[model samples]
Target: MSNIIIGTAGHIDHGKTALIKALNGFEGDSTNEEKQRGITIDLSFSNLTKGQQNIAFIDVPGHEKLVKNMIAGAFGFDYVMIVVSAAEGIKPQTVEHLEIINLLGLKEIIVVITKKDLVTLEQLEEKKEQLLMFLDTFDFEIKFIHEVSIYEKESIEKLKNSLFSINNSIKQEENFFRYYVDRVFSPKGIGTVVTGTILGKKIELNEKIFICDSQMESKIKNIQVHNINALEANISNRAALNLQGVNINQIKRGDLITKKGHIRGFDGIDISFKCLKDKKLHHNQTYTLFIGAKKVEVKVLLFDCITTLETGYATLKADEKLYCIFGEKIILRNANDTICGGKVLNPIIDPMKKNQKRRLLEALDNSDFTAAYKELLDAHKKGLGIISSTQRFALSHERAIEFANELENVFVDVKELVIYPMETKDFIKDFIKIIYTKNTYALLSNASINLRLKWASTAFIQSALDELVNEDFLTRDVSLYKNSNIKEDFTKELETVFLHRLKQEDITPTAPYNIYDDLDIDRKLGDDILKSLTAKKQVIRLQHNLFIHFESLNKIVKEMKNIIKEDGFIDISNFKTRFDLSRKYLITYLDYLDNYSNIKKVENRRVFV
Candidate 1:
């Protein structure tokens, strides 16, 4: 079945809720406060199904003070039903709602002139002409202008048929699933259940979802679409998810649910904004930001100037982390008045200079992703990851790679999703060359070198190694790269170097892995060398990581015996008093005394046997 969300917008007491009830036979104003007040207070949800077509209705409150609640439901709308009363014609809230829908880029408009029975035939016709003229000023496809009175059943059926005839569903073709929570509640038996429209992709039962605000993970214990049990829900389907591993207090309206690692939150985001008619957005001014059902107070900082402007680039500095995607629509308001609307350009915060940020935002505003990538690559010289392309640039991985391939003087690691400036390759080459120059017996591989340069991918490190091999600076022996100047006896030379280095350090020797790193050799080869030395008794192994030359062990044993003779007993404290070494060395040396035929163990102390 195809699903579409249609929201109602108009002034208060315009029959928005009654029209919904008449069409779907579902009561939208279910709460006591709403029933007593005879108005829609919060967002109410209902749906009407015809064959395989399911049209969900999000009945938003039309009161001026409830505009925030209206915006929360508007983000999920594919089409809007403008409810206008025939007696009053167009009102202030109607104009504001139309402007907001236009700013949100909603193109489909279905104007429903309600209460036609209350107005005379000529008066209703005159109101229809006025609404048609006003709607022409905005960009919208007037699907139809239908006059309806809830008292008449034929009018509601005609409107319902017109809606069911919509064959096209505006669904986002994204690979990840995202749902914005609009309503949250806990039942007596069931756990926390949240209702919202499925976006981006489909979500299946038993799938794990991540809550953005609480940073918690929950599983879908059950799924319901329009109050019908289902195993999965697709884009545009109004779903209620019974979640496990989270409390009702943890989730609320405006929280986001998505898969792990699909989104990265930012405390600030960049956008290209245009103010509403006759309104100016000032720099460094705080406003209420609404996106994906979430509303936050944000301070707007215009990129071009410190003064007020009608349209430009800006950054919204928010107090809380915002989980948003590129190209997502945002509504800005000051107090209760809708000020401006914007589209997110950069959802990921770039740590850069202000001027660079401006250039990047300027390029992004123009949809010049290549220039924006270049600007970001300048600051992320180590490498820039394209895995975040979906959230950062609204481009898929393949599309991002296509743009990356168009750039010059950059190395694109397609498999790793990393893009490095060409100069970074030279930086790696220079650093590796210094390592080989300092240690002629250095033997390394891409994996070993990756440990030293953790920021660079193994593919990037291999590229640098291959470049060195072309220049005859290094020779490849399978996966290992050896200095070209090294002799065939390099293995023997490495073993001798290790032994001599151990003797030089005497009683305090570095771990075998550190020795290998300092000498710029493969860890496996270092292990083999240490094994050969220990097999011949040329070195002594006191602890797992402690290895010492035989002569150094003998000398330490002699010094320990002298301490035992003077103190009549020697333990870690007395051994440290003489050698002034760390506890690791002191304990190892004192334990070695037990191997002596003349010594015996005395609890925590060592004495003559």
Candidate 2:
């Protein structure tokens, strides 16, 4: 069975703690400070069992100065019981606590009028009327209202029955186990112990848990639910866990203990904010944000025009990083007043520019993940957009491929997916435009393409290029690539000029730079022309800055093979004499032959393979 959490809210000395004791038949306050001061300073927990249902009561401090403690204690409450004294009626703290409860979005409230024995029947009737008027100003609906005097045993029994009736109607959540650390201490013989109300799934003994937003890991040594030894603790129940592999000093209030990889920490977050009253919120104003058991200082940046009680988008930049998930409700407070509260839309880095903010808002407004994914992709259309597997909107590799398949003609790689709003065919068309505009023959090398498109990974580029080649939009020849429709009208002219220069040299090919100067073409264009000829098998690039006509190289190979066949091997001097070539060209040709398996270089001689 799921546990029901009920929190008490009201002024100090108003019998909030006394009424708790009267209902459960035991004192909720276990500290000497609370007894000496005659008030609750921090949160105190107690469990009341009626039949099969168990209700957990969190008694929060009612002093105005301890309002932060009050907010912390009311983090995960399912119901709130407002304690108002019949003699005092409505006090300042009573209104403040009601405002906080409304801001927290808690809908169920049970007003308990305490100190009833101290007032006359007429006065009690008047007090009830005034409390009703006070509650009418808020949005929450009251579940039940009852008069209770701790001295009266019947009134206490009536309140317990009312609690049991409400427990049956509260809905339970089935989210993953998330327990906020409200108290961390070391008990003798137990090592480190953490106590908090479990807000999510059941936690079992020996379960590995991570301290949220931190790199600390601990295992549950034992579990205790409502002071009973248990193997597992159900959701909404108060639990004390004996933790192993962590020290008591390593954690504190507001740190979360949850299953690893279930949530991530973010420094900035976007929220849907609304003020409770006609209060103007300024940009860059610092406020305290209360979510779960954590309180973080955040600076507000409003996206829409500022107005009173208006709901709009805003970004909250925390002074320190905090861990939260989407749809988590947050309460914002100034130093003195509770201003507004809202639900988290996204938790991520800040959008630094107005355009990025617009894109983010548009993406968040979409109801489906696919639309949001597309908007994010459009925002980064100028380059590759990266979304890691750990992000909230990240799809699995299989799901990403499904999205790609759903969208026609869109290329996506599982290892490094790239999403674009335009079709992959259009992307190739644009890439062809770049290649055609830069070179006369509409050709580009892989290295050149990588330099122009630096944002894309090599894997993504290779995948896209292969898709374009399969689609007959481009052609690849060894290391050089070109558009399939490119005419290459100047290819023959460039090839004729290159071969003429090679022939002009005596027994050696001319260096590429000398040819570039002789032809009066740019070095890059010259190199592209030479690489194009080499790709077509019309020329052989023997080494760096060396080229030979393919036909002439083949004739030399035939003569060297015949000489090796007759003599078994040919030394460097003999090879140079046979070809009438210089030492540089002869050595380069021999290495090229060795590389192609046409000849084997054994020691200082070349042998026919």
Candidate 3:
């Protein structure tokens, strides 16, 4: 039956306790001091049940010293009972308490006129008129108000019925759980503890949550509401919580401990606010700004008091250190107290401002995804980059779609807060593509001085040369990339291969394609091909691919002949294997090797001379 908490508010000794006793048939003020004085010093409570709903009455002290106590009582109440004495009518405490309610953002309230028996018809009418005048200036949206006298029997029943109806009329808007800290105490056996009304839902034990922006996490150890050990507290109910792993020294009454990364702390995003009409607001004038459990004095930069505040509208800033990120509603008070205020743009970030574009843009440049795309495009214009969308948006997928749109020129698709630009894929296969065209099919020796470039990539030049065979750029016989028939002025190509291969294994050459993989190529065909000089004896061919066409194989043959004649036996296999040439090509030039009269081929791979 415990579902709603109804609080009584009015001047001191406004028959608040008497009224509660009449409603629930119980004395809510149980303390000796309060009983002796007939005034509620601390918060008093009683429960009235009808059918299945339980309504607890909170009789708060109307004294000025007890305003903080009033706040504690009101923290968990579902609906407020604004009790005004019919005899005394409206008072200072009534207005002050109303201000407190508005500050806390209470929405449901019912006005109760008590002690109607003490006033006459004309007197009651006059008091009601005065109460209406006061109530008209307040901000809350009240559903209904009624008159009742505690001295009459069933008067409490009448108020209880009204409260029950009002409670039924109320609805809780579903949102993430938020508990406003009202009291912090040390419980027996348990260390530091805090209490507040359960804002919404059931909290599980051992759940870790953040204390606003401190980034510190606290663990929920235990909970209690109204001296009851509630296994799980629901919304609109008061509760105490024992938290562990966080020092009470670090936590204060206003600290909001919540799930990490749930709420953003506010900062210097300029806001539009409605100031009190009579308050003088000058640009750059500093004032106190209170935003949800936090407050500071900020300067007013963009505001005009003459611009018609309508009692609750203005845009201003904070000159002091404070944090209330976004989607948090805030109030603007001058050096003097007031509650004129505004709401944030969204829950994720401070609303962007025009005046501080440079600073905001700087953060955006470092963070905003779309702006990053623009930077990416600029880099493309400079032929500079292909940066990731994650790097562009700083990896905060909160604004991922809008962040991806920033890279729209390239194309963007977002999934799971990840940005994958289309440009990233566009270049994957077509990267560095170049079209090679000719007037007609080119011969291996006829294309551009008989030199075909397979590729320009340093990592895959040899593969690209192999690719050239696929592309019909060169013959399949082109083992070395330099197997081109390209004619060049210098013998550098073959000579470089010779020097490298000779330095590698130094096997005597018998052919041209004597490539050992360990021997690195220093060959560049266009500039390094070895062309025979027809005017001089600069070429020789000892055997097959080992040809210097200018000496026409004679001088190399003579060298081979001298070796065989002088040594009595020749090792042509050693020379033939080194240049990868066949023995037939060696024999065709063997007479050129001079044979010294006899030539015999050995089956065990020997050369006979």
lDDT of each: 0.91, 0.75, 0.54
Q: In angstroms, how far off is 457's CA in candidate 3?
A: 28
lDDT of 1 by residue, 489-583 (tens): 57878878988999999999989889999999988778788999999999988888989999999998988888888989888877776777988
Model 3 lDDT per residue over 1-609, tens place = 447777788889788888877776678678788779777786665667677677767778888776556655765567778988999988878876776666556667888889999999899889988888877787777767778887676765676677777445242523346665655778677888876555545566667666774567788887766566767766766567788876667666656655564454444554444444455445555666555434456765543344333432234554423434333455565543553555442222223343343343333424443453454343343121122322223233444455455555443323323333334333321221222122111122223221223212222233334455555544433433232333342244445554444333322343443332122222233123333322233444344455444333455455565655665655665556434656665655554534445666555332454
- List TM-scores for all candidates, in order: 0.97, 0.68, 0.53
By lDDT, the best candidate is 1
Candidate 2: worst 10 consecutive residues by lDDT?
383-392
C-alpha-based local distance difference test score of model 2: 0.75
Arranged by TM-score with the best first, the candidates are 1, 2, 3
Itemize residue pairs with steric clashes in candidate 1.
none
Best by TM-score: 1
TM-score of 2: 0.68
Supply candidate 3's per-residue lDDT for 524. 31
TM-score of 1: 0.97
lDDT of 2 by residue, 471-529 (tens): 77667776555667764655577778787766666347788877764444446767888
Clashes of each: 0, 0, 22
RMSD of 1: 1.6
lDDT order of candidates, top first: 1, 2, 3
